[model samples]
Target: MREGEKEERTQPFSSPEFAPVKLGGGISPQLIAGRKAGKAEKVHLVIRRLLRQRAIQEGKAFLDLGTDSFYPFFQQYSATQQALQALGDYAYTARWYPSSFGLLQLREEAQRFLRTRFNVHIDMEKELMITAGASQAFDALSRTFQGECFLLPDLAISTIHTIAIANGARPLRIPLHPVSGLVNLQEAARLLEREGRPTIRFLYLNYPHNPTGVCATRAFFEEVVAFAKQFQVLVVHDMDSWYQAHISGISLPNILEIDGAKEVAITLLSFSKEFGLPGLRIALVAGNAEVINALRIHNSEYSVMLPEPCQYAALAALQAFREDEE
Candidate 1:
């Protein structure tokens, strides 16, 4: 109110941060509407109502079981508690931005986790990079390689289709084999052939697959590797649910386990569903150093870096999981 004193300016309503992200060719209105429709499907509504009714009858809270979240079980783990304490001690370091690739210790522990649990080995510095989450990594990958077409499981999570559409790529859904519930390679190949295989750039796969819960066999992976090599298509294998296989005493095959897989495939690992740390937003992309480097560079400009605290917490959780295995 004083003369010569400037008024306190309010932040503008519109800023660069609020601007719409132009993913690749740019996200279209149809893609946005499809994303919304996918999220508000009737089945989701029914499940939410059932959960509420169950919670009311039981006189207790219920988490969204549809998400396959394990936070309730995760919090009770001794390792989780220890990790939380350790994370609290180092939380102040969050004042700084962690390496776009993520923290070294976290990546190292991730390397060890893969080696010990899956019998797969990767170079921490070259073959792996930490992502904010599996979806973020997938989005970046899709944007980086906006191929003419993407081959996806007919029943894959909606995000896969949404990302494909947002990246200006045509999504061609392929059927699964009736007996094994694994992707039907013959059908996929036929579809690709029909679509003109040269336009096919990415084939997305998931195992201990979400919703359907199918696990891939080693032979199937061998077939997939051969198929990718033959077709010259890059395979993006999302093994985010790897822990589900461990819990079920099923030894699921990592695509990287297949010989020559790295030449045509990249695997994504997530701790969110496994460790009940979805809020932490940390995951890893492994295999194919060139692909990893591409994602690293793309993310540097267009992606938000994971904080140091999340990295420390992820490291602590990885250590705890390892100790429990021992």
Candidate 2:
């Protein structure tokens, strides 16, 4: 090798051009730019892939903090086990279509669960539809309301932000209160004022919020309802963790519990966290009949269904919950 070339290679490298950008909350500006260019997967998917590669090489067990560690509680509950055995007995002849609004029995049970738990009443036929999971629910919403502005918490779920971006929707992150971990409505109002309120489409909310475990109060939800109504924006509340036990010993308020909230808000509920049934992929989307109908029609064209087995499993879990209540 040439002497100068050898010296250059041996020298300590110091180049500003090679400096890396710091990632904050896994949502880096560079990452967002890459997603917009269609060059990146969602953050969790990327992490899972890397972890799988490491596990294969090392042959070591690693805990996935993002998911439950055991099989669903249904496997342990005798009632659900009996229910599943009965379902298997008829598996040969049970016919399920490619698409369904949801099983009538599951929806009816889900409605009862909501009323008994949150004291929130919903029409089983018009106000509720089963989804494969919360992610699919978000996917349907992103498509149904593409190209509109979505207001999201700066530190909330990265999946929601990534999905919104990929679907051509404009997502604006608003800062949450540092201590309370709630969205700053004043700041949100300012953004709406500056960006023109009509351009905004959905106000995203979460309780027993992911990653932070912060719960929303009924008063806060009332304020959110008023804000959404005033702005004429639809609210998408991700209540995926609603069924999970909170450390605070407080019963979480369903956004629908607030009067007038039903006119402006719809909520997504998942059984994964509470029942450890992530693989089953059954969830519910409930709220305003108009918005629910829009999602239903959009999904019909694409054809998505929560399989009968999953519907039945969810029903069994709800029944167990009801029995416990009794």
Candidate 3:
């Protein structure tokens, strides 16, 4: 027997100084054994296999649609190559917890831009929060509010349903009047009175609505806001498509502009449709301080801070727009 082998054989197994040999890197043998025999590996394998199947199915559907040749018209003006180049230079994770709301300069810029463009005033520090996107802002608001019943337009985006469901809320779809292409406020009021249990807590409004391209008039928005205030129900405004259309004379009034709106309404805005930077994932929420704070808290708990690079890029884009206007 070799001298080392003899010493190893004689060594006490009880010695605290002696540690088990690491299999790969610093991974212990027991962990390696567990990984080889664990249900976690099987679960991950199943998920990966299912994802592959979904991808194949989606590819087949795309092929059927002939999407390869038919490029859908994008609303944003930037070209694909330009967008890709911009993204290649973007670095998103240089800050801590995303300033608990967002970067101050970006928020200030957003406030100023929205105010100047839409004629709606927002306090950057008190009433606005920078979010991952309007999608996340809506989600955070819904989660924090914890309502039982939600009223939304029939033509609302799928995200409304998803956020409602995730927040333990039941959704009641109110039809958009075909003639006006706006939420039938009378019908919505009736539905709110009829389907609303004591737990019914809120209603959702969308303008320049999705799937159906209909914009609401100022009078209509005022009426809706009044109804929500009367019923003591919160209102969530999905303004994702606000920038998609240009209305004549009346500078696109946000729900925030309606009388008593700030008392009961939260407005969501996205950078995706407006700037054609969907992947950049910048969005904001403007509303009453209580509501905004609730969302901020929810965000701090459930979401990582928005990447600083995304905020900086969004700032740059906003500055470009301002310069263009000048």
Candidate 4:
């Protein structure tokens, strides 16, 4: 190397051999516009794909059970259609909101129906509220009496835990043992005593239990009532499936029938299972006046009053029951 001339500079660079090199300002306007439009089109394609996948995942194929085969012709008369027509005709006639408690006539009918059919007496004005369904009734009750712990049967429907959790309550499972297709009272009592506390605000009991087909005995219900009373715990008895199965010499016992039960129990019943009118969506809650009142207040704050059509339909059903008895 010459003294005046610096050593020749040398540098090494690394790059992929097959990589596409971008030429600045070399892409045409048309190509640039196409690329921009292509980005939006690809995004839309991806969105459509995701939507279709979700639809396929969630869609259910309809099954027709032909329920009319098991019902009397008159009993099968679609009250829902009649209700819709009635509502259509009276849509603008009144701005009336149903009582926060519920429609008086419906509540009376529910009370009278229970008294006559189940031999369970209730006060219509104070002990009952017409709910959209048993689900909403339970939801309101759970919200009203929010507690740290709930005692639920091990074989309970998923909704029991769901509602409890939504209301910030923890559920403790109580295993249900079977004795001749009824909840084993001894086992239940043991579990109840073992899991229960002052913090346990509610003990959930369901008879003609869903999925298990187990009914509770009068003795079992009395025991539960006693336990609840002793502990000052509340009982939410689900009698939704009471009449679905016919058993000789078996009369469903309401928890409230036990002495001192009014201090510790509330019962829920639904027309869905009994009448095969699930879509009609009507149910009742009955119990101590204070508990019912709290439920009603919570219900009013969180739920819409039962639609007029549902109330009317329930009233008609109750009227039919009365006429049949005569």
Candidate lDDT values, in order: 0.77, 0.73, 0.67, 0.65
TM-score of each: 0.85, 0.78, 0.71, 0.69
* Candidate 4 deviant stretches above 4 angstroms: 1-95, 180-198, 244-250
Best by lDDT: 1
Model 1: per-residue lDDT, tens digit, 1-326? 22111221222322222237677766566567546534533355455556655554666655665463443676587555666676787889988777888888888988988888778889988899999999898788778885787888877887777776767677788898999999999999888788777566589999878778887888999999999988888899998765534355777779998889989999988877777677678888999888999999988987569888878888888888788778
Tell me the spans in candidate 2 whose CA falls farther than 4 Å from its real position. Answer: 1-66, 69-90, 242-249
**In TM-score terms, which candidate is top?**
1
By summed lDDT, the worst window of 10 consecutive residues in model 4 runs over 3-12
**lDDT of candidate 2 over 1-326, digit per residue (tens):** 21123333344332122235455545455445525533232455556656644654575544455553243344575544544554565454248563467878888988997788788899988899898898888878878875477888877776777677766677777889887889888888888888876466578888877767788889899999999888888898888864634334568888999998899999889877666567568789899998899889877878876667767777776776677557
Off by over 4 Å in 1: 1-27, 30-46, 53-58, 61-71, 244-248
The residue pairs in collision within model 1 are: none
Candidates, ranked, TM-score: 1, 2, 3, 4
Candidate 3 residue pairs that clash? 92-307
Tell me the lDDT of candidate 4: 0.65
Question: What lDDT would candidate 1 get against the real structure?
Answer: 0.77
TM-score of 2: 0.78
